[model samples]
Target: MLTPGDGGAGPAVPVGTRGPTVQTLATGEVFAALDASPRGLASADAAARRDRFGPNELPPAGRRGLWQDLVGQFTDLFAVVLLVASAITFLAYGLQKPQDVGTLQLAVAILGVVVLNAAIGFAQEYSAERTAESLQAMVPHTCRVLRDGERRELPARELVPGDVVVLEAGDAVPADCRLVEAHEVSVNNAALTGESDAVGRTGDPVAAGPVLQARNCVFMGTDVVAGAAKAVVFATGAATEFGGIFRLAAAAPRQKTPLQRQVASMARRVAGTALAIGAALFAVRVPAGQSFVETFVFALGVMVALVPEGLPATLSVSLAIGVRRMARRHALVKQLLAVEALGSTTVVCTDKTGTLTQAEMTVVQVWAGGAPHAVSGVGYAPEGDVANPQPVRGLLRAAALCCNARLVPPSDRQGWRVLGDTTEGALLVAAAKAGLDRVTEEAAAPRVAEYPFDSVRKLMSTVHGDTADGYHAYVKGAPQELLARSTSIDWGGERRPLTEELRAAVTAANDELASQGLRVLAAAWRPVSDSRPVQDEVESELTLLGLVGMLDPPRPEVSDAVAACRRARIRIIMVTGDHPLTAEAVARRVGIVSRPAPTVVTGARLDALDDKDLDTLLAAPGELLLCRVSPEHKMRVVTALQRRGEVVAVTGDGANDAPALKHADIGVAMGASGTDVAREAAVIVLLDDSFASIAAAVKLGRSVYQNIRKFLVYVFSSNIG
Candidate 1:
């Protein structure tokens, strides 16, 4: 069994101890095992646990030293052949023709070629390693925990088993733990399990099964999607599921790129043919009365001449040129081989957000006071307008008031940017489009209190009050949730009872907007006479304010880019951590799936299939859309496609995407929004996060490969002459 101390400094617990599987143990039993209480361990106890458990981080796998990499550069087949020929020539010259320096010159020339190639290779590899190290520093490093019965933020690496950690929305879990108290807590376990759907947690114990399936346990590396919980850490570092997978992925050998394999094969064949020809020449000359030493030296000279001494340098230069060209087009190529690999990509597994579509959220449609209106423009620029603004002004106003996101005006080369949630930012932008100035509005009726949004409640309410109107609560959330809380609707500038027929009509409108791949949010307001009423009471009897339809619309250039991929015989498959319907809708809009009914697979459905089933699905002859997939699922999909002899390129922009990014033949990361870990893992970074740039990169990749082959032919032909 894996133990907390297996790879670190933790003290060994008793044999057959179930401390790590604290989910199965009762709350009192867990506290007993840890020698702690509900309040938490004392600072002194925490210090002892830290020494016992070591740092709460996965140990990095041992990497090859610079010396080893430098040595590897001169160890290829061609290099070995040249070394052997130089050695033989040196021996023959020393033994039979010490005074003559021709053979010595030849030997010196061959050694120079070897040393030059090794130096160039070493420099590139060292630079790449440094780049990766820099990128890893971008991930968040701190976590919140309770020590000495006081909640405080601490470096994640300081966490140890038995420590009590507090988890909230947007926080990455610091270590594996058993939930002591949970309130509507939902975790996105995509990094560990390859499932993008958020799983709810509870303090209740679960039956024995997969640890991930347990409702009472949360693992390290997963992010909290909503709610808050207090959990007792049972395992840290390599003992956690995240660390295990990290170790597994690290241990898996990196597959050689197609270009590398081909080059190796060509080098071996050239070396073999040169050796055979030299041997034949030696035999024929020696039998014809020539001295053995002279004949041998002559043969070695011939073999040395056949070796393309500048081939490595030329290949590097060609790839460097391609890299420079790609960089100008907004595609930064990190590795020389990746440039070649991109050309051979038969399938591009791309993420939807920030790659095919602009990552910015925008409000495109609005339904308020029984009227439908369209909001012009895209992104968070806040320069758009609604044709019929008066009817929807009330709804837009409530959405803006209920929002927490702040819109910052353009500054320092950046356009208008959102300071909080993108969804909330879109709402604020929509209100701006309807001529609602946030500054003026907030000044008139400042926010007095707020009932923060929670995943369980599916709504966020803010109490805004002034002397004139007393107090009013503005609420916004999922349309259905708001509809349920509301008792009346504002129609045609008048309030009316929410009848069954009207409710159905509102539901139909929401469905219609959702069907078009828009995210729908409803807004409502209530009159709260009490300045500080209970949150539950404040939410009662809300007046419905209709719905807002928003979407991260596909980039205008993407459709043409998708068409280009088709022309190049490259298949585009979208794999995202989004709803299946949304994924399909975006896929259609971007021209990825031409057929009206394409195969749409969800992560839940993917978990049920075996490797064979996945292979079968991949073998089907059309574009496939994978929704709500985790990093592991993406890696598996890429592996399956590769197993079938397809060259795969994957694009992503999160820390969770690092694994799949490293696993693919060519990984593309978004420069603007991608985490450092992802950028470090990827071979290419798109500065503008554009799909069109990827197509342009593919074109350049193909050209680079062709140019290398052309250079090889020219060098070999010249050597023969």
Candidate 2:
């Protein structure tokens, strides 16, 4: 059970127990159930539990031996037919009165072709699975834990149930655990859930749901991007959510490509025609005074000759050339068969962030002192400006001071990176644009304490010491929440009462920014009694400062790419974890949604749909946007599209995307930001993580299909002649 600190990690409390029910209980109750204390489990108890439960690591999946994989490469129909022809040729040479050297040479050449193709094919496939080899690297190796009333660092795999684990910013969560104490903890679940946004976690009891959605819980492989927490380990190893999903992704069978199906059809037809002609020769020759044995042998020779011995080799070479071409265009084709399958793609199910839009967050507008101000710049470079940086100076300063993200300057090998949450990073960048360096600001009024943001409060505040007016507390959060906490407004450089009209004005400004596809957050501050005021006391009597809106802008080249897809008669559908409004806004900006009203389905609504309902929804769409989707929902969408005979090409970036990537006809993954699990399942990896590369790949694939047809035409013509 996911009992906070209740129940041992031993056989008494196995993984996969009803986590939500256990997590919904109070921390003290869970502690009683686990026989654990706030200080942590006694070392003796932990060691005893460890003896019953296995190590806190996922079980390794069985893999095909290298020799087995190599053997499989030679077992296809084309290779088998060529092998049979080579054997027959050798047999015929032996039966000849005098063995012909040219016949022996012909047999060797055919065998060589089969061996060479097998070697090349095996090598290519082996290289593609490199990501799988490093799957264990996803989890952190060491973590800090409390035992016997003392804190210590230990290998994460050694952690047992009932252990109180300490988590801080930048650490990967070692196991599934319920938080006992959370301080402004926000986790980046994108590695497991594909939700690009970092969500706040809390220690308070919440409604029962999926363990991953449990407000007080964190799962394995996710990153603690901000704040800190103390949680009790409940599930580990194969019992964890990450491990369960990993197995699902591994178990998903690979779909046969279009080329494979066509080759099989060609093989069947060729075999039938060869048999018909052979029987016809045998029937006529035996009756025309020829020896039965001689006629039979001659007919067999003709049949063997009918086999297209060079087809497999030629196709492999052509596809290899196409792979090289796609690589040069920033699309790495891992599966050779997917080259032709990409050409047959009828629908493109793509991601929103990093795929169609720039993943970097940029502050576009700032509302301060009752005036809207514009900030220029696009990324984390800290090279933009806020016009007349006087009125919004307080807003910018609060945004910078109340944030945890750090900006790394451009280095020799890499460009600037936000290094933390994108939203916080954008705030820091906005402050930098106004010549208010975070390093300098922190020095003037160093931060003393902070009340970290929690799911319930929806607000975060930090207290800074040495302020001219005693101590100052800066707060930033949802506009409505911050405004409700305020008693006054900083309007036109004058402190004014936050009247009903002023509140409406702020709300109207927030709506205007939301309508523009920007994520808006309001800022407020108030002088405090001391450096460490209670959250309840400091948050009241506050001056509502202003609002800041940031956006993850659409990529500059995406419009043309979307146009190209439309011209090619391929459907583009957006599947993301964003809100419906945000999803529709971005969808419209990128030309995916052209009509004024498009079909936007949320994950909750999708969960209620059956197969027929889902089909109707997909079929009734002008432009489809599937928002707030979990990994399972994304996979279902791809499965539904495929059931309708639509050749699906899906793009993914997270570990949860692995199954969907594996199931699609053409699985395109982002190499730059994608998880190892996703890259392992994908057939194609976009090296540059750009949607334009996918379009280029589709064009390249069509060219490869044309090449295949040309070769078929040439071969058929020669055979007829």
Candidate 3:
């Protein structure tokens, strides 16, 4: 438990029976509150601290001892060989007298050198863990909360349950709390969930009660990216869900890298072989009347040769080279062992938004009445064309004129422009291609009023045109919402009354697009009287326009990257939270399809497969696509993949992406726009968020592994010789 107080290092008062006592390191004022009383606060801070930090002064104990750890290093074959040699040399030449001093000095020198090497190697390998401690320090230093019925600044750790905390943009939430009030509040839970987008929250109670969705619950260790909120703390300390997760992550043993495992095994083998040879030499020589001391010295020399003292240096250099290569591709590799893990990756689970798509979107399809037009290109670029042809251009003109969105001139990227919103920009561009200038259209049918999109309504309506010309409006959003309002259809490329049959037909078309992995949005329009403005009423008598399909287009270079992985005998599984069609579409575009076209499994389908069944399915010899998988299920998929002896690389930047990233053999986070928590937990950061960079990182990893192998062989042969 933590306590918040003045920044001055003086004293702190512990609250409740379970609260922890704290004292200022400088002033030595102890504070322990049996109850909120003056007498309780009068206690010396020094006494309180002594009762706390002192009692916890001793570090936790665990498996293995310091002496054992030190001894283990000497168990290596080379160390054993050297020890035997030293013993024999000591026995052969007496070092107790001046005459034998020269021989004694030589023996001591060899022993000293071997011991020094062993000490240095052990120290380098056994350094204490500091990463998690450093990360914990990053928690917010201050928190805003109500005290004495007024908002005030307090130390974050002092936050208690039921306390009302104030949050603002960019502020890290100090504790787990239930939102009481919110204003445009959006929290980025990516650290906990692996979701790239910030989830909008409200004061209303969220579902998934008690264990409320982290999306709505302002969790400790998360940050508010935009707007302000007021929340009551429901939990803190180890009781917080994230705290438990952290404990698990911290307690998880640092898994050994493949190279490390191989080296340790080799060390055992060398030790065994040296022991065998030493015994044979000693037994044969002592009976043959040869000096037992001479035979022992030879065995020691053999051990030194077998140790391959330079192998560790070689392995370090190879991994360092790999790290440098990855850095060139904008990938920051943390542990040297990560390079080895990347080389063995058989599955790469990547994020959808920024990883696969540009995250820069554009309106591509527009429909009004029976007219449908296609808008070209994406991003802020103005280099795309509209494919409306002749008659459809008028509808496109209406879409542009009926909205208030605009394109700002680009400061860079010549022949390019940025839009207010991607969907609106699409209309503006479509209007431009139809020979309708956005400037002229805005002037003719100015947006007199507008309603922004909302989750419940699922529609954003813009009202335009003069009262005399009828209140013309354009709406675009989810298909279900649009379908409810639409009463007519545009069939045979013409507007017609929308009956149940027409709605069914349009729904089928939308379904087709969805099946093809297209994110479909429906558009519609209606003319109304200005005097009776009702945005809700606008939905029931609309004409179904057309459907648009958008994709997080695969990078042009991803095809080559996938091919490289395939050639290296690594299986690539495209795991995404996006719709199955969408995930499948991107997979196919990136050459992820099996020769017969891989099977696409939805989250529901994946959940139905038990671990045993999953193993069988994975081993069936073909590619499998898992789509719309939740974070928990994703972790399971990774576990399943690894259980099949496949090394996995899970790449993402969202909060929802965290679990799988943690579970994979290697977690690659996108540095740009990636949450600090994701970066902390990931082994590698793709600074460029490019799939190409991932491929480059993998290639470098393989190279490092190859070098390690070369060093191992060299060490083995030289040691044996």
Candidate 4:
């Protein structure tokens, strides 16, 4: 239970008490719980709720002031030791019978070294913080809400729980809300879930499971891509899921990297050993009647000599150089110490989309006419060879006709650009690659009506006028839905009644494609008496055209990167929000999981396991995959791995991935596709969002450790002289 301060602008709502339960309850029940109505809250009641609930803005991330940052630079243990030694040198010089010029020179030099060290560290820290501030720039906005039966545009900050907000295509959802009424509403949850697909929402209530998967709800930070809906706001500000993630990210404590801990330990040991040796000399000489001023000066000189005067500057310079080299490889290091940590990384927990996979969806296989045909080529390019295109032409043509996406020819600056949905664009590109142009298909069977895909039916249909007098409808959607509506099949260039056996075969085919991690869609068609307003009946008793399976292919360089990680003895484990089959397939494709069937854990199963059980599973030798996991699950896994002395690195590109990114020893974020929340939480941002960059960074980081060792030897040898 989160409240206003989750990250947003107002007073935080009381924990577990203020959030209204909207998803599980009936619409009427929800309205009663919030004391809301279709007409909306009366002006007086709305004012009171606003006052009680605080502002609707998420709390801003706290930033350290320049003064605070500078103060921190001087607080390092090494710097403190040098400062103390410098002060004592001045005291010893003053107490001497005759002022020693050499002692005065030593004190001035130590002060100068301390100042120089502080300056270098402060510059880098300030620069990194300034860059982060650029990423945090935000703007306030407005939303359309109904108040006392009148719809008005108000600041998004003014939105309160129980406000009925009208969502249209292209409008950002103002708050987390339960749908009261929906008309083909579809939302893009990419910001919140990291999945780019448009998910359909309904006004129906669901009794159980995660609210993230609730069909009756729409959440903040999501954009309405199609249709319209009236949803009642239930959560706002930090209380919303969007705000909750950033809150967790900000709240998660980042531990000191191994290198940082080791450096502090070394500094303490060196300072302590030098002081002990100097103290023994003073104790032995004092009994022999040596002057106090003489012994004090001698002890202070020994301490100064033992200290690594140039080490701080050299180390900062070395790490800064590593940052530059990593940038060339497409990784930006936000934390200077992360360079050393990357080299020591033993376990990498990565997300599926944008890291290992190219994230560009392409059609690879088509099942039609009782035979399977493989489509060649990659991305949105319509330049693939379709094996036996003539047999599958009908399926491709009908699928193209039913889609609303358009493809723009390749321009000098960019490749083909998809105007509408990427899934539909894939269908259009598939048709073109098979020599079935969209214009040609449309002219032959011009569409007169369309039924957009919705959460309920899970299918979209378009009624088209064919060469014959009657109208024909082309439909494409979830394979199961289309299969249930289908009564006949296009069997190898011939029409046949779909027998029970044939239906079972079709079901098997769909399952086979899905198990291979392909996004499968079924195509079907039916003849209608007239091209009047399209209705649900128009999709019934259709002819099953077959299925097309698409995949977000793994990047060409990921395999080599995986091999590099293996050679480095870094265990790569995939943790994704995708389905288990999809996660495993991508894991195998990228070489994260080599086993034929790995021990895959779903989020639900993970939730049931205690810490000891989780640790046992993770310690097992076989390939491990976790799918359908939430941010908490990811963070939990990172913690479990760390408990076994593994230095973990987690990669992510969505708001949901923020907490894990913050909690991990190394958080690598995708700069291009990652949400701002994710980027803010990560210490390393990959410009190309490639697993290869991470491998490259680790290589460069390993060199830093060698550089440190070399610097230590040189300093020790120089001090001996």
Candidate 5:
């Protein structure tokens, strides 16, 4: 846990115009003047640190010393029996005798191995402190802040409450603050909240605090996804960042995973039984007038026979092997315990945005007039042939010209890549599928004008010059917005009258596409007056294009991954924040839910359920998806699942996911796209971030668990003999 001493408030440096300034976050109260003051803010920072840390705040309890730590780590029954036997052998029959030399050397070897095991285990467990340090490294060492109307670079640690900080794209927030002003700013609070897309920021004071979006609030440790703004620092360091949870989390002793706890319990029982047998032997033989030496040797032999000294070593080796195997399969194991933990996982909570679906979105559905056109393929690959190729050149031209993102050829033509948002990329791919060769055709007919896509409008417009005729504008976005503006529809068969009835039919088609787990995008276009630029006069869409459908499409190997979990008796629960329909659709595709009446638990309903209902609901098969669940709800679900003797592994990559990630027996996070905070908290990180990777990880985990079990069995049998 961090105190003010560790990268907290230090001496403040003077900031020139556009420099750091201190003011209250909500009230705009000036805690310290902005003009020409260096020590002034420093004094305030010192005071804040004192108030936060305080003299009354106690330090964590000191840990055992190296020797004591080793001994304490091996507090298992097996170790205790060995220690007792060694003491008896030394006291009774001296180690100097020839016969005793063999026994003594063996005893010495056992002690050496035991101490080595303890040392290694303790070292590995304590290495997580370095992970914390690594996390702290993610924070920018220095930040440019506005003080006395001048911008100056100062250590980010010096930032105190109420300091106004300038933000730009890619800058990790220096401290937590409420936005005083913003212009087209959006923060990716995915680190703090699990929301996938960037949240739009505004200067307006949040009217409803209940719905806590990072829109108006700039939080520490969160990066600006796009745009720029100024915000007053309300919190800093541990207090400002994720509500000082890091400190609490770091200080909290790393609890043994449920499997570890169970193994430890079993090990202790085995050790106890061995000791009891040795004690009984000593008691029975000693009273028969046998010498202390004879009785001691007899007991010592019995103890050695029962104690499984190599069990810990064998378990460690198995885990190491499992980790290596997983790494070979592209799933890096951060914590060794995670390998075993995956074997015992009962529920796997995964994120929807990037984990289950490709992070890159594409236009899957095109709503043109009264017709629905399904776009083929998932992601940026342009190899897949369109299911229904449209022969009309104008419709293809509209889709190509109307989109913002363009497909670029990689080094190889077969390896096509996109240079835009997943949604826009999807459109480009769809345009390509429509037989509009964007790379060659767009070059020939060049884009004359274009308007970038924005959230508020939710549509992108582009005009192409020299496209057979004069100019055409293709528009793709929300169906409701496009339908409201459209004047007519082209029903491939004929130019049909687009009435309210027809519009509802189009809407239903889009809904049907969505119900099947395809993200549907409505595409429309108009032949506008080429005299004016495309942006100025692009609002009136004359034709409604066909609807396009998209799905992340399941990983090819996920089916087998799910089947493997089933074979191991692990129940797979997909917990996500996606719509129930969408999540259910994906689950069904992955073979998680085959039945039609699959039970789905929503976040709101979960909150209302008592423990009893929650427990009963978990056992119900066919219900694999929990949709729109809050972080707290996830924690509850994980805990409840665990209470029912099911091992839970939660996979997530957002700040809201932190609590459940910490609560679960093992937490897995996406390595590539996951936020640093999420990775820091998770036990395992999926480097490839594929469900297939997780499946492979689970297999490795199971192998590790089996090896541990095998060692236990071997040790027990050898001892009994």
Candidate 6:
């Protein structure tokens, strides 16, 4: 049923129909098949093609109308039981005692409770659904493409097959396309493949592989990270690789929350018990010389009393209050039963970014002139100070000059914002903390020429100087790369010749920082006599300035929340798309894994395990950390945990997280950073994207379920009295 290109705005393509394999075909052949060229489709032809292929977008999800939602409110088991009880009471009273107004009043009151509860539930659900739909509109809606040989911006929905789309760093790929040209292109396929690392793309055709892995192809929903590319759209809308995932997620059957299942079971047992009691009373009283009408009336009263008529209303009020309490703590509950599900959560499979950490990179330490200086503050805000700024001034200057990212001053209510990569932004912030102004520094020693960072070199260099300094090249990149190229190091305001011992010491320092889960970047500089020296020549025999240790620091409140989870008998497992070292470091910092040598599983290792192996792993786990895992791996882990009788809660914020979010007992999505698809699939959205909020929600959820049980006990006990 999920056949690609089957249903859309244009003519339907029959399932199983074959066409030219786009990836295997030459660029010219692909262009011919699409009726397009390098010049791109003319306006008239583009319009016709648009009409034929339809808008390139996922079909809007069908929503339940107000009327349907109202009807749904009365479809619960308790509501149905109340309706039947009212009808039976009315019939028995009318047939046996037409003059009795009390029986009629009782029937009328029971029906009123049903109507009132249904109306209240309907209003709450209707409002919540509307809010969720409005949030979905916030996703990116436009992209750049070529039309009639001129580049123009257009709504992503209007893109069709044959369109020549342009992609740049930070741009989300709008549709599936084959690369016609690429310039050091690298894409973050986290949304599609769940790999946090950026993948390099090429225009050259691959001989054989899965289409998603082809070097010349780019799929929808992924973002370009480090380069530019011109790709010809070959698959649009639901026909793309992303669409297959969309269909898979859409088709996945929604399971009943644990609360719903338990509630239903309790309702069935209570109903059966009430029926048998009523029947026994009728049989015994009628045979003991009581009038038939009197016995029937007595039995009716007993059934009504046992039914817990106020339960529906009480449950609604309790859940509503729980929702409000969670909202105050920055967790928005989308479904009432999800609150109860959260209470029962035994394992929380949380992502590292935005959940455990701040998700904003910050420079915490700088090693320069043979001493370590700590940098204060945690985000883009330039309010922190560096310890001993004077000694590290050149190091900070080099960090600022070698970076391409810019920091925009706080505008309106917003604080400092980064215009480039977060890691680079951290460097700029560090420079600011060290009393270096990038604008002033650049003006004094303006850039001449530069070498941009590439996947192969893993380094970036910027030449900035006058004729006096002879064009000093400031370079920053992976510590290993920079250290290998450096022949000397700055020590105590003096340049020393790089010796074997010094090199080993630098390597040891880098390893120490890395072991602590910090991302280390080495800064070095060299004099380039040529105003425009070649990158390879300009990067050699440089003086190493020092190393900068940065980290997306763990949220200050998460450690307390993790401790609370432990106290509540809940196990927190970190499943992330980040590297093993980074994930392990964050996990240890957040207290998710206390042991120094916790089990860390990767996607590759997960793939190698069978279901039995996975089940065994889940069973034996003291504390589990899954790193560099894809969405499928997350879902599998959730499923395996469920099979072991543990209630699971999954937190995520990407398109790849949608399926697992839907599959979990309670899916918690990040309201601030989550994709539209992820938000739609989740049961709860953390407005602040904090682990602390999730812990608070669990506490409130437990209270909600406890209150419901207390109300049930009070109602049943009152009926007995």
Clashes (candidate 1): 1
The predicted structure with the larger TM-score, 4 or 5, is 4
lDDT of 4 by residue, 580-606 (tens): 777788888788878677999999999
lDDT of 5 by residue, 38-121 (tens): 212344553564465432111232445667855676775545655654565454346233466667776776676667666655
The reply for model 5, stretches above 4 Å from the true place, is 1-99, 115-177, 180-189, 197-199, 218-233, 240-253, 365-377, 380-422, 432-474, 490-505, 527-538, 551-556, 622-624
TM-score, each model? 0.85, 0.89, 0.70, 0.87, 0.77, 0.93
Number of the top candidate by TM-score? 6
Ranking by TM-score: 6, 2, 4, 1, 5, 3
Least accurate stretch of 10 residues (summed lDDT) in model 6? 11-20
Worst 10 residues of 3 by lDDT: 22-31
Best by lDDT: 4
Could you tell me how far off, in angstroms, the CA of residue 22 lies in candidate 5 after the best superposition? 15
lDDT of 1: 0.79
Q: Give me the displacement of residue 146 in model 2, in angstroms.
A: 2.7
Show where candidate 6 strays beyond 4 Å. 1-35, 96-98, 197-199, 410-415
Cα lDDT tens digits for candidate 1, 392-431: 9899999999876678788765678766566777888988
Candidate 3 residue-wise lDDT, 1-721, digit = tens: 3344334322222233121211111111111222221121222542343333222111222436768867876675545555655664565455232346655665676576567656654453343123323433443378887754667787766665545678887577886666666765676564554343456777654334334353446787666765677776545654465554544443433445556566667767766776677677777777887765566655554544444555544655677667778778887776666888888777787776667666544555554444456667665455576674565555565556544456676554233443233445555665565577777666777777777565688677777776458677777778888887777766656778878777777777777767656667777777866734687755558766666555545666778878887887777777776656566676777788846577778788888988998888777877777776776777788778777777788887755566667777888877765544455557777767777888887788888787777767776776566
Model 5 Cα displacement at 446 (Å)?
A: 8.4
The candidate 5 region of ten consecutive residues with least summed lDDT is 10-19
- Model 5: how far residue 237 lies from native, Å: 3.8
Candidate 3 Cα outliers beyond 4 Å, as residue runs: 1-177, 181-202, 205-210, 214-244, 351-353, 359-457, 464-471, 480-512, 540-547, 551-556, 577-582, 594-610, 627-632, 655-663, 711-721
